[model samples]
Target: MSKEEQAMKGLWDMFKKRMWLDSFRMKESLMAYNPSEIHCIAYIGEDMDSNVTKLAESFDMTRGAISKLTKKLINKGLIESYQRADNKKEVYFKLTSQGKKIYNIHEDIHREFKDRDQPFFNQVTEEQLDVILDFANKYNTHLDAEIMKLGIKMRSDNL
Candidate 1:
């Protein structure tokens, strides 16, 4: 095979492995929340009292799916629902104490995964990190444009 092809294959393999490791970590540690749920919770934690529609757009999920999932989260006491202060008709979701607990667990799982995978980048230098970051941003931009063409949502910034 050509050197370029070999490099591409290696990158694909690394991405696949990363995804698999993340799935495994979620499965092993997150007893109550699925990956999607945990992702939603994390987003809410990041942007407190965000409306369901915004959350749906951010995650590339349907509004109905976001609503159903948020309802389940509310029932589990992991999130609380409230009316938006600026717009009374718009309902927002926020993480409760129980939600914070689950978020902390998710953080721990992420940390453990990072620690275990440290060897993969143990020798990477700042210059290499910059190159990787630039590549990632460009790739994400291309992907975002393609997704937008398909009528999917697009972020304000590509990366």
Candidate 2:
């Protein structure tokens, strides 16, 4: 309602829009795989302890959904499942050579993105960068708390 409130609201809206647009562009660039599948691949590539449960938890998705994605990735020859010698009942996923290629491409894209933004970042003062980082950290912490609250509410509702 006030000028300051309106300005802050506008800034937040624009920031959200920019992020959505950037995500859309990235999705378009990685047309071979959908965002979820690429994310799963990247996660498996990075974390040796990755499993369906871990992937689901990391992505805030259902195990069933992650299982379906893993199945699709397997069908595409991007990932393979193996059982740990210590735990025969549990299955884990690892990226195949093909999956590694996709992961590399994703990494390259991110690297290029950062490189492209480096000039602007280089111009930002340390104080300004710190302010941005602090804002981001606080915003993410708030979102995590909200997600936990929603999870509790959902579990209670299901009872």
Estimate the TM-score for candidate 2: 0.79
Please give the range of 10 consecutive residues that has the lowest summed lDDT in model 1: 150-159
The residue-level lDDT of candidate 2 at 25 comes to 62
Could you report the Cα RMSD, in angstroms, for every candidate shown? Answer: 3.8, 4.1
In candidate 2, what are the lDDT values of residues 4-61, reduced to their tens digit?
Answer: 6996798789789766766776787778888889889999999997899999888877
Tens-digit lDDT string for candidate 1 (98-145): 899888888888898889878978988999999989988998898778
Q: List the candidate 1 regions with Cα displacement exceeding 4 Å.
A: 84-86, 119-122, 143-159
TM-score each candidate: 0.80, 0.79
Most accurate candidate by TM-score: 1
